[model samples]
Each structure stands twice: as C-alpha cells, then as structure tokens.
Target chain A: MNAQFKKGVLDLCVLAQLAKGDKYGYELTETISQEMTVATGTLYLLLRRLNEEGYFETYLVETPGGPARKYYRLTPKGLAYTQSLKDEWITFIDQVNRLIR
Target chain B: MNAQFKKGVLDLCVLAQLAKGDKYGYELTETISQEMTVATGTLYLLLRRLNEEGYFETYLVETPGGPARKYYRLTPKGLAYTQSLKDEWITFIDQVNRLIR
Candidate 1:
C-alpha cells in the first residue's frame, strides 16, 4: 500500500478505533497496526494532535509496577469529526471509483 | 476534504482521467476539479512527477489562435501505475470501511 495513502486514512482509523472504546496509546497502536501498516511515530503524533484539537480527551491509568498509560476517548467533537472524515472518504472514493472504472 | 488526503489520491485520479484518453494539463485539471476539490498547483506538480516517473508522456497540440497546449497521454507504464493505484485504493478503502463501520 502507498504510505502516503495509508497515512491519509490513519486519522480515520485512529478515530474509529477510539469510537469503539477508549484505549491506551499502545493499545490503540496495537489495534490499528493489526489492520494495516501504521508508523507508530506518526500514530503517536496524530494522537497528540487530535487530543490537542479537542477531539479527544486523555486520562492516565496507572499500573502497579509501570508508568501510567495514556488512554484516548473520543469527545463529542471527535465523533463529529470522524463522521465528517468518513463522509469525505465516501465522496472521494466514489469519484475515484467512477473515474477508475 | 483534507488536503493531504485528497493529495494522496490525486496521482491515482490523474492517471485514471488519462486512462480514458489523453488530456492537456488544464483540461485534466478541469475534469477532476468538476467532481471534487483539486488544488491546481498540486495537480500540475503531480503531473510533472508522474511523467518523470514514466507514468505519462506529454505532447504539444497547437491551437488555431492560441499557444500550443501540452496534452497528457498514458504510457504503458502509466496504465500499469493506474492499475496499481486502483488496486491500492480498493484495498485501502476496504480496510477503512471495515474499521469505521
């Protein structure tokens, strides 16, 4: 798969995963990486950006013998953003499908 | 639409447009822009890059009373590139759809 293309949809994938349920940074990485190629560096950067943008809120959960895990939960705004990105994906793909066909 | 996202697919879109037939630079841009947002600057740059990568060939077609228009036609390589991009698009979208669903 094209890396740029994959990067383009990573945001959507991350948001969608969070939509399923909140997950810690590594957990989110694990879920998305399972489906496709994810540059962990890019994923973490995206997570921070999304959280900064108010699309997500993060909470730290501490483990007994380890550092706290930062979990991401989609805020209402993030849900709305995800829907918008999904809609754009649909419309964009539809046009490409028609052209390629 | 996210500019980066749209950009990621623009190479595919441009090649798909030429797959039908040849087109001049502005002509190709117009055809794609009609359906979705296309940054002309980006499209031209993509055109040049794809051509350099051997995905397209260009020729000048003189007009009756205007400057010659450079047209783009798909080469064998361009056709193959288009197919690969189409395949990538399909696979990428499938993953995204499944995730977002």
Candidate 2:
C-alpha cells in the first residue's frame, strides 16, 4: 500500500471503526492493524486531530477486565461526515469499476 | 462527499489522471471537479507536496494552441507508488463489498 494513501485514509477508517462503538486508542489501533498497516504513533496523532476537529469526543471509562480506557465515540458531526464519505466512495468506485471493465 | 475522504482520495485520483497523460494544474483540477469537488488552491498545494515527494516531476512546455503550461508526469517512483495504492484500494474495497453484502 502507498504510505501516502494510508496516511490520507487512516483518519476516515478510524472514524468508521469508532462509529460502531466507543473504543480506546490501543484497541482501535489493534483492530485497524489487522486489516491494514498503521503505526501506533500515527493512529494516536490522527485520533488527536479528529478529536480536535470535533468529529469525536473522548472520556475515561473503566472496563470490567482491565484499567480505565480512554474511550472515543463519534460526535453528530462525525456521523454526518462518515455518510458523506460513504456516498463519495460509492460514486468513485463505480466509476473505477467501469474503467476496469 | 466527505471532505476528509476527498482529501484522502484526491492524491490517488490525481495520480491516476496523470498516469493517462501529463497535464497542468488547472486542467487536473477542472477534470477532478467534474466528478469530485476540490478547491484550486488545495490542488496546487497537493501538487507541490507530490512533486516534493518525487512522485512527480514537472516542467514548463509551450503549447502551440496556447501559453506555456506546467506539465506534470509520474516519475518511476510515482508509478510504483500508484501501483501500491491501487493494490491497497482493491483489497480495501473487496472487504467493504463483502460487508455491504
């Protein structure tokens, strides 16, 4: 994968994952790394940026099995943003599919 | 479309377009804007970044039909980079497709 491409999509991918449920930084990094490669530092940086952008809000939450985790959840703005991304992706892929065929 | 998604995809999209042939800044912006919205200033900034990264090399070429234009084409590194991006995109979309179904 292109590092630049990965850099670009990491934020949105993180958002998509968080939209399903609140997740702590490490857990989010672990999940995304399973599907695509990303560094822990990079993930943290992106998370901070998204939080700063108001796409997400985070707070400390205690887990039954472990230490308190900094859980992250999407803001209303994030959900709306994800929907728009989904639409654009569908359109872009449709065009690419045609070209490939 | 998601501005963030657009931000992510724009570089790949621009590279893909240039892979077809060399083009100037304005033409690339106009072409992409037909399918996706992007500001001219953003396009130039991205172009500078890509050029700085050595993904592309640019030179001014005089056109018989008009003024000299700054044409951009992929370097060998850029082509390799684009190939990597394509592979990642395919894998990512395949997963997304399965989830959609």
Chain B TM-score (each prediction, in order)? 0.88, 0.82
DockQ of each: 0.34, 0.12
Residue A88 of model 1: what lDDT?
73
Which segments of candidate 2 are over 4 A away from where they belong? A1-8, A42-66, A73-81, A92-101, B1-8, B41-66, B73-81, B92-101
| Tens digit per residue, CA lDDT, model 2, A1-101 | 22233235555577778778888999987887666556799888888988898998889988899788898989999989876666655676765543322
Worst window of 10 by summed lDDT in candidate 1 chain A: A1-10
| TM-score to true structure, per model | 0.89, 0.61
Candidate 1 lDDT over residue span A1-101, tens digit each: 22233246778888888888998888877776666766678778988888889999888898998889998989999999888877777776777777667
When candidate 2 is compared with the true two-chain complex, its DockQ is 0.12
